[model samples]
Target: MISTVLQAVGLFVATNIDDIIVISLFFARGAGQRHLTAKITAGQYFGFAGILAVAVLIALGAGAFLPVEAIPYFGLVPLVLGLRAAWSSWREYRDNDGDDDSDGDSATGKGSGNAVGVLGVAGVTFANGGDNIGVYVPVFVNISHTAIAAYCVVFLILVGALVYIARFVATRRSIAEILEQWESVLFPLVLITLGVVILVSGGAFGL
Candidate 1:
């Protein structure tokens, strides 16, 4: 049970780290946008719940067909996602001559005022969480349904905590700047590391 809780925490952190950036951006719009914060939080939860539902169904279906030992190979999903993210970041950096500002502007522009509504935020959260499905499916496949339910409970609580943390960070210019500056590099690295952890822990390579 302790291990399961720890695993849940780790999974939550790895999968949602990028969300902090997005949430912070939303909160950074100043006091006038305070009301939208609740909407964004609700959207994040709703979108994440949708992603989990899909992953759970897929995991159950795959579990019924795939051998237990082969489950870990699903780790390849996140591995590939990480590699693609790295490639995309590299391309963006090269294209912009290392000016990260352009990338930031592009991201902010896409999600700006356009995402003030609950559904809009939900859509953004779901879109950003595409890679989350890859990471979650294998984890869910290996765990019992009860365990999955517990994890979901933990995740819901953590989601609220994450929103609060993001709100706090939005007011901290230095930390927000640092996170924004390093997020591209950090996010891919975290995903890659998570994939390796899943593979090893799942005994994919018999390690």
Candidate 2:
């Protein structure tokens, strides 16, 4: 039981660490909007839930993570999202003369999050979840449903804890200041890099 629990915790962390950067950036962008924060939080939960659901389905079918070639397709989700974010930021800077960040760095990533709302973030989470499905299937296959339930509970509780930590990091004045200056450039780049890595690693386009 303890071993199973440990495996669950390890699996969740291994699969989810990449999401921390994306999720934290979202929280940072909307730090001032309590309402938006709630929505993003829920979006994270919904997105992860969707990933788990897929893993369950595939595991029950006794299959692997996905077809090898199809793995690269998941990369497109973040690629598109990153491109959308870059476009939005560029437009905001052009429209506002690049000096209108009194709201929360719209020229950075705030508007993208707002415009995409919960669904967009959820989409990113789901698409970025290829590794999650990959790691989850083996365990889900071997475990009983009751154990699966426990694993789910542990994974979810840790997710909430992760959110709390990342959100707290977002609220720090030092981090916030740096993010305002650099997130406009770095955030989209990170998403793009994530997508590219996923694509290349999955052997997309014969790369």
lDDT of each: 0.68, 0.74
Q: In model 1, which residue pairs have backbone atoms overlapping below 3 Å?
A: none
Residue 148 error for model 1, in Å? 0.9
lDDT tens digits, residue span 1-207, model 2: 898789888878877876777877877556556576677777888888877777777878834555534756788877887887787677777777847554554544456443536776787787788778787878888989988888888887887777777777776899878876777676678778878888888788888
TM-scores, in order shown? Answer: 0.58, 0.84
Give lDDT for model 2. 0.74
Off by over 4 Å in 1: 62-115, 173-207
Best by lDDT: 2
- Which ranges in model 2 have alpha carbons more than 4 Å from their true place? 62-69, 99-116
Q: What digit string (tens of lDDT, one per residue) describes model 1 on residues 58-93?
A: 787844544445556656655655575577666666
Clashing pairs in 2: none
Candidate 1 Cα lDDT to native? 0.68
Error of 2 at 94 (Å): 2.2
